[model samples]
Target: MSPVFAALKERHPNLRPQFYMSDCADAFWNSWRAVFEVEGVTRLYCIWHVWRAWNAHIMKVVDDARRSQLREMLLKLTQASTPHAFYSLYNTYAEIMNSKEYMLKDQNKKPRSLANTSQKNMSSTTVANCGLVSAAWAQISLPTCT
Candidate 1:
């Protein structure tokens, strides 16, 4: 717990420790609160458990099919050897609720992801974390390689 939380509770009598937090019922809610919604600001949690809760079931059905088709590409992306190549690979949806035929139509345009790239698009800090360079942003450097 942050000192700010302790202080806020002192200021507001209604704000119980539990009120300021999500209980076992509001599971993701608590994780969200602890991370992003401090003082009403929130950031998405990037934890695997959360993802498994959200997407694991959706992806299980087509897992073998995808592995046969693009396992190698998926492997490199997982290993992060070619961070940029991830966008060109297959995306495994943890919450695959739609039919395979329906999903595949949109999959080609988006490409499969080893990551949730949409989150990065929502935050610049994420892009930098991934070491992405802008296509339009030119590089200016003096070559030093012998």
Candidate 2:
């Protein structure tokens, strides 16, 4: 991939690329992180893939009866109008996880690992770098007449 990209860059110095990929593996993300940083490329995560990962994670931790409702709320966060709103919802979710009712049901199970996975996956760096909160909504503001 690097050799191919290097050749292209040599042929077209003005050319810039945007790379979109799934969060299927940490290796995949790490491999491109350095390449994108050095080449000044925009790295975007596929929303469909993101939803797949989110759904998988939620299914493991959330109750079956409430999974559908919780999944809907999780999806809505992706459509948040602002980063603050996104984080606010995230914080609310965190608080819910810590509540007495939640703790009793959790029963010292695997919720901690679940929370860690969600936190790392939703890190500020990932959100900002992928422009999930801003670039997404910004597209709607473009004038259709233009």
Candidate 3:
């Protein structure tokens, strides 16, 4: 990957991407950063992968209706047209996760907060990267690459 990036740079000295999207892989990110260290590149994770990971957590919701609501909220967060909308939806989702209304029972029948479970499964870095991707998309109108 570094060699390929180096070749591209060799061919086009002015080539600098404003955004680079990947599947949230550590190797890809490390390579990208190594190649574009001084460039202001907004790293983005694939939205499909992000949604798939979050869906696993959403499926754990015991209440069907609440689960559906959470699914919709997550979808909205990913599909938000603007950074402001994304942030708003993200806050609402976080609030719901932290609230007592979103609870699951342990084997002992004691309630456990979904917030803890979610935070355990999904790191804050993933959420922050998603926001960066959303913001980059909102600010640019780049042609889609195959």
Query: Which numbered prediction scores highest in lDDT against the true structure?
Result: 3
> Considering summed lDDT, which 10 consecutive residues are worst modelled in model 2?
107-116
Candidate 1 error regions (>4 Å): 1-40, 67-124, 127-146
Reference-based lDDT, residue 146, model 1 = 12
Tens digits of lDDT, candidate 1, 12-67: 74542311212212344455355443563222323243234224422533466664
Ranking by lDDT: 3, 2, 1
Please give the TM-score that candidate 2 achieves against the real structure: 0.52
What lDDT would each prediction earn against the true structure?
A: 0.32, 0.47, 0.53
Residue 74, model 2, lDDT: 57
Instruction: Give the C-alpha miss distance for residue 40 in model 2, angstroms.
Output: 6.2
Task: Output the worst ten-in-a-row residue range by lDDT, candidate 1.
Answer: 136-145
Model 1 TM-score (2 dp): 0.28
List model 2 lDDT by residue over 66-131, tens digit each: 677666765665555556776676566546555613223322121100111344355554545345
Of 2 and 3, the candidate ranking higher by lDDT = 3
Top candidate (TM-score): 3
